[model samples]
Target chain A: MDLVVAVLFQLIYVIANLALISLGLAIIFGMMRVINLAHGEFLMLGGYTVVVATNAGVNIWIAMLILAPLVVGIVGVIVERLLIRWLYGRMVDTLLATWGLSLLMVGLVTSIFGASTATTVAPPLGAIRIGSYAASGYELFLILITIVLLIAVWLTLRYTKLGLLARGTMQNAEMASALGVSTSRIYMVTFGLGAAVSGLAGGLLAPMTGVLPTIGATYIAKAFITVISGGSAILAGTTAGSVLLGGLNGIFSFIAGSTFGEIALLLAAIVLLRLMPRGITGRFFRKSL
Target chain B: MNSGILRQMRPTFVYALLGIIFMFAAPQVLQLFTIINLTTAIALAVLALSLALIWGYGGILCFGQVAFFGLGAYAYTISAINFGGSTWAILMAVMITSAFAAALGYFIFFGRVSDVYLGVITLTVTLIFFSLIRRTSGPEYKIGNALLGGFNGVSSPPINLPWNPTSFLFPEQVFYVAMAALILCYVFAGWLVNTKFGRVCQAIRENELRAELLGYDTRLYKLGIFTIGAGIAAIGGVLFCNGVGRITPDVFNLYNAALTIIWVIVGGRGTLIGPIGATFALFYLTSALGGQSVLNNNLVLGIILIFFVLLVPKGVAPTIIDWVNARRKKAPGRVRRRRGSRGEGAQ
Candidate 1:
């Protein structure tokens, strides 16, 4: 019984982790139809933000919660105004430009920090015992934070004027512009918001994974897989993809190993894509946001 | 003189002539080390040319061209070890990698999925290869006599003269082979785009639905070009390891993948020579950067990419070509027929 509870916690943690890393990518891709290949770097920037802040003796929670997102959000806006704004309609160009941006960010961070092993940013939370197994309280907190983050995003998109304007612009930019909405501003803000989410997730992840200039490469493929596998609808598709892929990965990793777990996850995604090319929500939650 | 084919192939012949001249001249003038570096650059140029064919011409932006590339290297290494000959092993390796590409492309092109997601699928597959190969440590990962070597990577057998299996090629001889292969592949690609099949592929690139409406199976055509591109890239893979002396899973990493795209983008996506030129230029540039400590290579490349995409979207070759044409127009000459226009002529 304790084993099941522990396993379930592990499964949920994995799901939440995947969701957290991928949510920002989902928003940008799902809403804007722009394939921001630099998304992993955005997350890495967030991690670095927390590292830089905490190294200067700031509170870890405040750095992760506030500073990381704020810094990366600003970076996202600058990226939009400088690079992404020009390559708005060209998806392929957007991918290439962002890829370059990702590389640039890695280079900049490496030059500043000096590329080496992981930076130390230890989680402050203690382990919480459940029956025979002890789980890191940080993992539980991450799971709870992921849920809260998802809810917050949902409320923002559903209730906020900015969200509505962003959605309207994405749906039909010309129509939104005709209706007096600043589509360009919306694009910038939406991109910034996505980056902010990525930043928060990265900051949150800093304690668990540590900060590295190239650390984004590790999460990038998986995050892209999740977002692309989720399809068009931002929230529901992301949740569905995380639950499915993350669950499969967790169970397989537990049964076999990390490598096999990764293989299974990729294989499942390829097969899933073969079946439903548009992604999970492309078929199931077609009506949902 | 009367045939359009000869006139059409004049520039290609000129390119081949220049390549041959360089192949002969460079070894005499440059040091052995420089020649060796040039060999590596040539192999990468071939890789870039492969992308120029598939993505540039066929309109298939394959993000994981390195998957087939790495596979070919590993396959050649393993087979050469087992067979004790590189000639058959090279053939076998190219065939195997192309078959793998065909299978993967089949799943993608025929799956009725939107084409935009193809990049993600290819990248995912390449990453899978990267991670999977990295974990192949220990004695358990040996194929026949060759160890998978895990992360250490296996050294490749040198390409020997086909008539004499015992006579292994020196580094200089391998450079000649790499240059010869590059020239042949370039001419072959130039010839291919003029064929009916290439014409149909270009039509599909322009408008897939319109090509489909004309009763052409766009999927099969894409699969064909994808396989051919894979085969050519496999050949590049074979030469690349010979130049570098070993094959590693790092070839399948995102860096190499991105670098390959950078070559094509900076060279000129739609033109063959553009990417080949870009590959050489950037290859040498990065190699020079690898020697230095002051600047980060990634940062430099990133800036170049952004600069090219924003300012010079048409890329180096087209920009130069346009400039020359503009100059020619300004000079006292009749408005001659435009040689390399946008669509098929871009090659």
Candidate 2:
């Protein structure tokens, strides 16, 4: 049925967006051992930036490409320097501080933007017809862009000086520091990079999901669930978990309804966490941890 | 000579007595609105104490306690209206909420999940509960007395009060009930924390591997504590609905949970009275500032949280206690005697 296919396309879109968010979270949490609760808020800010830029008459795609990483990265750096720097080794402190920060940011945004959902930025005019099914050109472009970014990230991590240093730090911060690498600088930059990636994700998905102050809260749990289940393997695993969650969500929505669909997703993620403690792609990255 | 001991004892008794007296006498003098606000604060304080038990002592940070609060609220609304307008219906609601929390805790903590993941799991559970219940409340919400009233929620039937039972609560009676519950909860928690089970939990927090090596099952303790915490929070939620005479899904929002955590952290995690005092103080401040622009109210709270977290991470209670201890002058030649009595004197 048309409804079924439409739902399926929407599901794919959700998965792709979630994968992008989770991939960045995986790097920040999995690699750096920092739980940035405000990371989602960063995505929120980035999405708003793109929306504002587009409203000012900039080309939508160009606005996203230019503003997302830069704004998020700068915020990330400042946050690292001012707040997160003091919480380097303390997990609980970091959790509390960032939790507070998340609340503060959400409150500020809500006060400024009001509670109503923002109007979504329009997607570019284009549709690609495949057989009898038609898909938005924008959706296809998003998928392709994600794939390209994943590959590019993989290549960079596989072959680059900064990548090697990052890997070393990920394996062991103390040992890496002892090897004469500036662990402090790496931590700041790494956090910034993670935030930037999240921003990029927000910017790209703004057209699909829209720019709302509390929008991040909707996807954050799903993205976190995906990252936890995907294990810290690579972008592939994150994407795989994303599709698994997103597809299941869509299928369940068709059968049981949207509310039940979300409940099922939560239940499934909990079960997966219980069964696969190490996650789907956990084994591959075992040595790195 | 003995005055030092007497001086030290004054604050504890003074606070207790003042709390009791105020509970009885304040409603007589204050406006009706203030009385209502005070009652709400008591409910919120009780809820904060629940967080203190789980996060403070158990070292399990649950970010979704509002789920249980909401469940208890919804359960009470449904049961009270459907079954009967009796106290027993409310009790059943609280029990059901606890049972739900136990089932949730068993699945997450006993599943060998880490602390951070435990928080995420709890958040997911809360979200699921919110989404499902909000949607389901559409049609069958009202089954006789069991009507959910949809998103609007339900309230207790108004009845003639001996002395305005709903609002005034006969002054002393409601306050006594609150005080009794507080004392009972505090004593029970204190005993539990000093028990062998409590020792195992503390050990687990410090070193999970060593605790396991000591033949203690950490996961089971975590689950037990988490369930207890949820139950305690539900107890507070029940009181909250009764005091307010109504309930809504919004009452169980994530903001309430965050506020509870703020109370715990500011009060000093692991300290019982700290959370209680923090809750009361914060509510008092909120009440004072709610008259002003709402943004100013929130800005004040945000600033206080940021300041306390940065400068006094151990929390107001511990910091104050430390300051008081430092201010006391030690008796000359007492160092050796105190050192000898250190283990016993620690408490």
Candidate 3:
């Protein structure tokens, strides 16, 4: 019973973590058809921002609250204006270009910060215990904040004028332009928003994983896998993908080992993709995007 | 445009011949260490050439050629160390690695995934392979021979060449061997590009639907070409292990994979020789500019890549070639006639 509880707790953590990152990917892919290979690097950038600021004597929470999203948003704008904008339509170019961008980001980080792994401290408060079982307050805070953000995003997308404009631009860019919606601005803003979300996710997760130069290198692939498996179109799929990947990852890591767990996850995801080309949640959001 | 005039001064081909001559003579002129580094660059170039062939001509854009390269590296090390020393061991290793690549490529290409998605699949496979290799440190699993050293990689005793003239002349002998192999690969690839198989592959790249409509099996060609490329990459890996005198999991990491991709991109892709030239030039540049000694080498590399992607997308070699062609075609009458035709077409 204790073992089951431990597994369930870990599964929840994994799902929440995966969903936070995958949500950013889903928005980018759905809004721009350009699979941002550098998405993980953006997450790493956000994590690093908080780390750098805190090390410079800023309060960790305050640093994250102020600098994380802003840094990522600025990077998004620069990347879009300089690189991503040129690769708007050509999918392969976008893939290669973003790959180049990813390499540049990693190289720059390594050069600037050195390759040594950096760590961040969690909030000083201890775990919140209920009976014999205890959970980190930090983890709970992350879950709550993510939940709040998810709801806020859902409500905004479903009931806002900007959301309508975004939806219009996503569904048919030329048609939206013909109907007088400014899609170029929408594209820029959506890219920035996606980067901001990635930053926010990074800030929340940094306490657990800390700040390594290649921090998001591992998560980038996982995020892409989650996004594809969950169906790029559905918010629910991102959640589903996160839970599926995170839970399977945690359980398998516990059982088989980290390497084998990763292998098994990959093998399962590939097999699943072969069986369901549209993805598991792709069915529900087939035409939504 | 008589054949003789074109043949009399093909600067590109002449430059290539000059490069081959210089590489062959490098061992005699340079120190032992420099010669070894050149050989290493040659081996890396061979692998990069394979990437360009697949990505440039076939339009497959595989970001995971290093996985195949790693497979080859492991295969050669394991077979030679365990099965006893023989040249045949190396040959078998290359063949097996090629077969593995073929199987993976078959499933991937025939699955009807689009080219863009194929890059994702290949990249995923590479990362998964990296993770799997790292995980084999546990006692439960062993990678082939007992020497498969997990993250530390596998190294072996000096290879006992069947026709060894002298054991101490290893570096010189290896340089000669690498040059001969490179020439053979270049000639074979160049000839293949003009063959029916190559023509069909190019057509598939140019227009997949038209090729399919014409009843050509596109997947077969992609698989065949990918297999060939993988086999070549394996050959390069074997050469690499032989030159380095050791192999580590680090040899097959993301950075190495990124380097291979950058080599092809920085060199012209469609032409086989482009990446071959690029591998040498870039490696030499890195060595000369103190790539390893620099504090921020990765950042410098990143900046270089970004610059190339933004301003030199056709790669350095192809851009230079284009400039040469333009200069040679600077006849006023010919230029006027071309402009006249363009103006007519616009109207």
lDDT of each: 0.90, 0.72, 0.75
Arrange candidates, best TM-score first.
1, 3, 2
Q: Top TM-score: which candidate number?
A: 1
Candidate 3 lDDT over residue span A24-131, tens digit each: 778888788888888888888888888888889888877676689889988987888888887688787777677778877887887778788776756645797644
In model 1, state the lDDT of residue A98. 95
True contacts kept of each: 0.72, 0.33, 0.42
Evaluated at residue B82, the lDDT of candidate 1 is 92
Q: Please, what are the lDDT tens digits per residue for candidate 2 over residues A1-289?
A: 7756666776776677667777677778766778777767888888888887888888987878778878888888898898888877777678768767777777787777776766679877589765577889898788777777777777767788887898888888999999999999998988898888888888888887788776777667777788777776556567667877877877788787777678777778878777776676664445432
- Would you estimate the TM-scores of all the predictions? 0.96, 0.88, 0.90
lDDT of 3 by residue, B114-134 (tens): 676677767778777776676
Residue range B29-94, candidate 2, lDDT tens digits = 987676666666777777887788788778888888877777776676666666545365557766
- Residue B259 displacement in candidate 3 (angstroms): 1.5
What value does the lDDT take at residue B45 in candidate 1? 89
TM-score of B chain for each model?
0.95, 0.82, 0.86
Better of 2 and 3 by TM-score: 3
Q: What residue runs in model 1 are displaced by over 4 Å at the alpha carbon?
A: B1-6, B330-333, B337-343
Interface DockQ per candidate? 0.72, 0.47, 0.48
Please report, as a residue range, the 10-residue window in candidate 3 chain B with the lowest summed lDDT: B338-347
Q: What's the CA error at residue B17 for candidate 1, in Å?
A: 1.7
> Which candidate model has the greater TM-score, 1 or 3?
1
